[model samples]
Target: MQHKVIIAGGGTGGHIFPAIAIANALKKIAPEIEILFVGARGKMEMEKVPQAGYKIEGLDIAAFNRSNMLKNLTLPFKIIKSLNQASSIIKRFQPNAVVGVGGYASFPMLWKAQRKGIPTLIQEQNSFAGKANKQLGRRANRICVAYDGMEKFFPSDKLILTGNPVRSSITQSAVTRQEALMHFGLQDGKKTVFAFGGSLGAKSISEALRNILPQFVEKDVQLIWQTGKLYHDTAKAAAVPYASHVKVFDFINLMDFAYKASDVVISRAGAMTIAEECLVKKPVIFVPYPYAAEDHQTFNAQALVSKKAGLLIKDSEVGKELGTTLFSLLQNKALIDQLEQNIEKLGNSNADMVIAKEVVKLMG
Candidate 1:
């Protein structure tokens, strides 16, 4: 019989991209396998998954509103509705296994799958586990993780350290440094920095860079900045004074090129970002978003910092210390090389394949 699997979850690129990578790896290993994705309705995955050439079913789900208690009045109803939707999807698809990758949709789908006695797997991407994953993990057949010391969160016996899967484009980029610089209209022979704060953009990072644009021009440094849509207009307006030294975008379509062109990186400490940086072997200074659930982004950055593979500046300190820290790091070639070497050692180019194989094992 042909095996069918459902990969569920996705609110951000961190979850969506790794989910896609795992699907691709499964296809590569077992050409006969059939895969489907389930994500929250109106979320990025609903659009991104289809573009990735997979069939997806979206649940009428939304996360609990932590900031506004009034907004959560309908949350229970939404969860109940999503549970019904998840059940219907699983019943029709009859997947041999259901894999949850932490997101709003994941909880309902995995809960229903486990209730039906279907084998389930959970892929926990962050150093700190989300509440949903920690709860569903009890019955999950296998729990694939990207960080060490996750035993504190999930059942130790079920944990497997497969690392996080990054997009193949990053690991297999053919773009050269010269071509990358040219693509962004930046000249060679100057120190270049690539800064981004994930799909939605980061305000603190943008503001920090804006405050130091004059320093960039004075020191002969070039920049490739992804401001996200929210901050694009403001960032673009600010960069107008130093257009030659800075290239700003709401979103960057070709990140492989951006990685190739940069001497260093400044980014949010999302799990996927860290994974990709490891493969690209760039020396990164991370500014962990303070608002992340359980302050997990800081934990993610700390995993790398403790090993001397990366540096961290808290989100609060970005404006005060980011520029000075970045300039100092740029001048230290020896430290740069050390960070590059250590981070590369942490890269697992085959994480998707490993996770795929584990998923297959659960199927059997």
Candidate 2:
């Protein structure tokens, strides 16, 4: 019989893309392998996994809400219900091993697998391990991570610095500047500053950009900004006067193109975005989301800043200083080149394959 593996997690592209990367690596090594994806029923993974050509099952699960205490009142029931559902799915799939990428849904799935005596693997993308990953790491056969000194988070003996798994298309792509500008329908031969707030968008970043559209046009710098879903229209409306030099959207499906065209990038410091930036060697100014678990986004950005590989600006500071900071960086070619070299040094294109190899070996 071929090897069977179950990959768990995904509510965001951060988790889903990496999960899919590892699954693809495993298949590349052993083509006949059977893979099953376990995710939360109503999450994005259900749609994304099918699109990626994988079979998946969703458990009814919900995370403890920190914002509204009342929302967490029913969390206990959801946890129990999800755990029971996970057990049934595990029994039916009969995977030789389980791989977890952190999200609320992964907890029930990985926890049940460990109890059943199946070898489990964890790919923790953040600098600070999440509550789910930390709890599961205790018994996890292997813990794959992107950053160093994770010994404090997981057992030193189990740590494997496999880096974060990136999407296969992204890993193999080389989207050039001309091509990327064309994709955005913006002209070439101008400095491009790429700004995005992730898939949902960042209101502060959007507002900052909205207030400074004239500054970009005045400087002759072309802009490709992703305004998140909420702020997309506002950003577009603000950029309408400079529409020839500015392109605003809610989301970017062709990220490779965006990365290729930009000279400097302004973004929210999410774990996956940091990884992708390193891969593309773009100089970035990160505004860490203040609300992420344990303030991990700042840790992610700070680690790069410590290396002098990127810049950091707080989310609150975006409203006050985003334009000034970007203008300063835009004018300094030496600084941008230095940042490019330093950040590119940290890229790890094969992390997905490395983690997959380690997991398969653990299973055997």
**In lDDT terms, how accurate is model 1?**
0.95
Task: Please state the error at residue 133 of candidate 1 in Å.
Answer: 0.4
Residue 51 in model 1: lDDT:
95
Positional deviation of 121 in candidate 1, in angstroms?
A: 0.8
lDDT of candidate 2 over 1-364, digit per residue (tens): 7789999999899999999999999999999999999999899999999999999899888777888999888889999999999899888888899999988789998999999999999999999888888989999999999999899989999999988887867778877789889999988899999999888888888888888999888999999999888777777788889998899888999888899999999988888999899999999999999999999999999999999999999988888998999999999989999999999998999998999899889778
Task: Give the deviation of candidate 2 from the true structure as CA RMSD.
Answer: 0.9
Residue-level lDDT tens digits of model 1 in 1-364? 9999999999998999999999999999999999999999899999999999999999999988879999999999999999999999988999999999888889999999999999999999999998899999999999999999999999899999999999988888999899999999999889999999999999999999999999999999999999999999999999999998999999998999999999999999999999999999999999999999989999999999999999999999999999999999999999999999999999999999999999999888
lDDT of 2: 0.90
Best by lDDT: 1
lDDT of each: 0.95, 0.90
